[model samples]
Target: MASPLITLRENTIWENKHGTVSITPRSLCDVWNTWVGPGVSNGPIWRPGLAGLRALVAQAEAQNQRIRGLGGAWSLSPAAATHGIMVNTKPLNYIELGFRDASLDTAFSGNPDALCFAQCGASVLELYQYLEVRGYTLPTSGASNGQTIAGAVSTGTHGSAHSIGSMQDYILGLHMVIDGGRHCWIERASKPVVSPSFCQAIGAELLRDDALFNAAVVSFGSFGLMHAVLFEAEPLFLLEKSLVRMDYARVQAALGTLDVEALDLSGGRELPFHFEVVVNPYRVSRGQRGAYVRYMYKRPYRPTQASAGGSTWVQGDDVMTMLGTVTGWTPHLVPVLLEPILSAQLAPVQGVAGTPGFQFGAADLRGYVMSSEIGVALADAPNAIDAVIDVANRFHWSGFPAIRYVKGSDATLAFTNFSPTACTIELPSAGSPRTLEAFHRVWDELRARGIRFTMHWGQMMRENREWIEYGHGARVEEWLAARQSLLGATGQRAFGSDWLTACGLG
Candidate 1:
């Protein structure tokens, strides 16, 4: 890795509407991405990869003894940073859309339980497009799919649904570079340890402890380098997504009973395949639904000319769109810039009713542009929402909306990681400093009140110093103890990163 200001310019994020946004690097050392995790210089920075990355890390290990790999810049927290060598694995992006067995059976075949061998840098959107080709889908996903599979699972990226778990829940196994970079494969504990031959086939020494394995599955970047992930996906089906404005009063009445009881607008109600609740701070006086809620119903796949018909392009676009939204322009303006364009993207929106593979909440991935600055999660859905409204009433920062909804998650870092016991209360906005200040005031008030809510590892929520203390709290200790136990010494140092220190996770 070299050092040169001019070379570093390549890694900067291109804020302009048209032009390349690449990481600036004088040499390999400066290479990084759009993500800024702990101690990282603000903005995009390119990182050298392949031998260059390993060489840097090796040198660090010989000296400072700390180096870590970073997946997607999806994390708003510092979990991806490192004082030593930081390998930007984002370029390792690739999705091998194939299967292994839903039963964890090595022999079975035939789209066996919709599965994919996702690389360390493969984005969720990319994985989705790969699955679409084969007519398969994952059980769930986060609001958007910009995060890499490795980052999403490691950080416990969550979607709205409690019945299922976080990104880790669907992850059936892992392929990682271990001590001295020994590639290892981990799966749900097996009866006989995957057989010596099979273990060698995938290049790993098998381990079978439920506690350690589970903890490490969602271990964030603190775990060793993740090269690939084996996730269990669902059958290919269409998700009939529909958005409706919700009534604040009715929502208040149905808050507790809503998600838990199901029975949305489709009669006495039942949970849709997917759900989303968007709160508008400016809507207090407006007569729109309390919050815009969307529901998705599952259906069999059927392709047409209008549909991409099992193409990778859909997911590819979704990835770029996810990244673009973070810049804070209305996603609704997609037609203005991208509607007529044809290019590679994971999740596609080409004015088609539905694609052959499937669909989920907020089908219009393009219409949801949002800024990356504000991210906050309030614990106890009902309590969090009330507190938000109360604060808004007091400060008149009602223009910003507090999005609500539930998603299934079991990731150690997911805000709603615990079921029944967890529900997310997020505050999202594309606004001015005054409105943002109002948000902070309320967030601080709730923190003082001791409301536990896990913040999204990606998106906003990265600035809260006491985030883990308030969100993970007791569970944090349990996970830390469990993680320490799982990633024992000899290899623990390699797994440790600045990300942990930033979140007070070490």
Candidate 2:
């Protein structure tokens, strides 16, 4: 079979918002042939199908070369970098729907209409459109729609859905090309979905293990390159969104207990589908100040003659761009300058109703942006927020903080691993040394206070061996054991990178 046309650029300078890399892909292969390369070859390859991906992994293992997959390049961290071959999975995108048959096992009793197989490179926006047309919708998604399905789940990207968990929670199955040319489809043994025949048709060995499945869901490319994912989607629905300004006390009440009814929201006693609070640390010091809050409720889908609102399609300007304009104007005056900017950015308490696809549309990438996020137990949200505000005030930092909640995820390494509910506190700011220092201080203070927290895998974090050990504890050992079981010592060495090594995962 003919190979896909592959392109290679040598000594290329890859720069994202946070870091820069002088990547050197010694040799490049753009082909979909599983057996294209001979044993002991160091050539880089771009595989467009499952067979080709497996072949490339086998070749990398044979040649003792490290490999990594790149998708969208939206991550601020360097987890995707490799010292050897880099496989660009952008061209391998493919999507399909699952079907039901009598041959299926009785354990496979899920709604067949809700099953979807999305290839590694398929972006979230693309999947949204595809599912929307079929009267299906993703249960939850990140604020931005540009991230690929595999990348989003692998890095534990999440939304502010108080009920729904992170993206990894909805994943029913994972199709992966592991080291030594092994291809397998993994799912929970307790709740098996796909039949053996379906796995065989896709040329995969079936493995129904709960721990292995949970570990691989958020492996961050360490469990080998994921070829595709099987997602369980929900029926299409509308979201009624309202953005309002509330007093700090009211916002604190909601964050403290997550009891929306206590706050006297419009939908009394009914939990909101999505809730978020954006706060200005400087303003929080004033007893009378308020924060911007957004609430979204799920509604049954209905046909309407009216077109979607303009605001729904256009996601306004990037917050990073707005903050960048005032950079270097005056560090101390940042709070004052940001007040009006934030108001303008989050103004007009208008109501909007639309499908999830239109509501959380594509994200616009702007100049350098860096963010740090940590997940803490919901009961500790009040103290955590206060500590963060203290750190911001003490350092006079220009960045602002926001809090979003999500149900705890089952993924072993997910930052939202806190049981019951977890609140993710995010600090996004213009990339600067001062901002980085402030971020580090926040972590240091939280650690000193004995506050147990986990950092987002895809965001900028002050991660070290001790931090990982302290945050994850026994789960860290379980994840490492699962990794060892899936990818043996040689495979781990071939797929691991410096970031993984620094965190003691490699």
Candidate 3:
């Protein structure tokens, strides 16, 4: 049966807001419109929504064409772009919270109320609003709440939560459409969430394997089309945010060692829910206010609590606004243009409190901005920052570096795979050829300095198989082995893309 939810247009040019990735596909397919609630529906509205996605996969296979799923189009890399068929999944926004007693496995031990089943297209902001009203919330999300749930998790999106892991860490299950349009409900064998009855009712085969689950959770869309995800949500809480400016020398000690006392926040030795440091590369000398520090402490939820309003520094989705205005790379002009903006935006704000949704809210796409994130061991962060600063200054790059720490993830392909904790340094700069050249140089310089690092899959970086292997080591082979075991030869080729091939993952 032909699903009415699927629409295909020929010869469409798909371009992202950042202009970093542009693709003119043979066909652009929009996969969904109306949200089909649970239960088998014989109606024209497409009772079983997976039928459309499955049909798209079969079409791609039969025609011998590559197909890729497009989410919020938030990725700076060409990860989602394909020359054959591009499916826009933004309309697949559907949220189902809580599970039925019969639908859950008897072995399931976690709270069912904390479980959320969200379609691939559902944005992070939507989930935030949906859960907040029901007295629930996600444990963590990226700095900005713009990317779709599937895209964010698959790419290993993270924020400054050293205690908590990346967004993918909370995921318990994945509903995916694999090779030849075969749909399956995948979860960890050791930690089963849904029962076989649930899978049967949803018209999916049940497969509980930890290796497959971990690989698919952060596989960057190579596994197949992610129809939906089941993630563990937490009780609603507030974040008390404080932003302050300090000299580079003052915070150097705390960079490698995450001693909360050294940060000098109101909480003293108590660790923060979120911690990040933004540095102006041009002004890293002693006594200079080059570091802008932000810390958010967890607070009990209160209905009477005043909103903190939306004012955050460079962290997640949005680019550096100051660098976006610069047309060319001019070292002299960069400091002159940056200092005033930094001074105004980096001023201290204390005792402001809000929910995760309010603190990290909507962000507009900046086309002129480009970002490259590198993850290294927590203890190696100070040295990494120094390396980046040197490269930025020498290259005359018109941007700054922001440091964030996250607990290492168990996901096989996660960039934040460093043991204990991973410190991620994000460089957001003007989108220029010279800036890209500088990024390539940074990768080389880091390698030369023997600083082992991994690049974010969704962000801008020089793609090299050797670099990927250097960063991930044996995890790459483990991920590939999992893919081979799950998808087999046919599905691997169907889901493979140029980007995946470039990184040696395909």
Query: Better model by TM-score, 2 or 3?
Result: 3
Please, what are the lDDT tens digits per residue for candidate 3 over residues 292-333? 888899999997344323444443223354465453455336
Worst 10 residues of 3 by lDDT: 308-317
Per-residue lDDT for 396 in model 2? 72
- Model 1 score (lDDT): 0.52
Sorted by lDDT (best first), the order is 3, 2, 1
**Per-model root-mean-square deviation over C-alphas:** 9.1, 4.1, 2.9
Shift in Å, residue 344, candidate 2: 1.0
In candidate 1, position 191 carries an lDDT of 24
By TM-score rank, best first, the candidates go 3, 2, 1
Candidate 2, after superposition: displacement of residue 102 in Å?
5.6
- Winner on lDDT (2 vs 3): 3
Error of 2 at 301 (Å): 1.0
The positional error of residue 119 in candidate 3, measured at the CA in angstroms, is 0.5
Segments of candidate 2 deviating more than 4 angstroms: 17-48, 102-104, 285-288, 304-335
Q: What is the TM-score of candidate 2?
A: 0.91
Give the clash total for candidate 2: 0
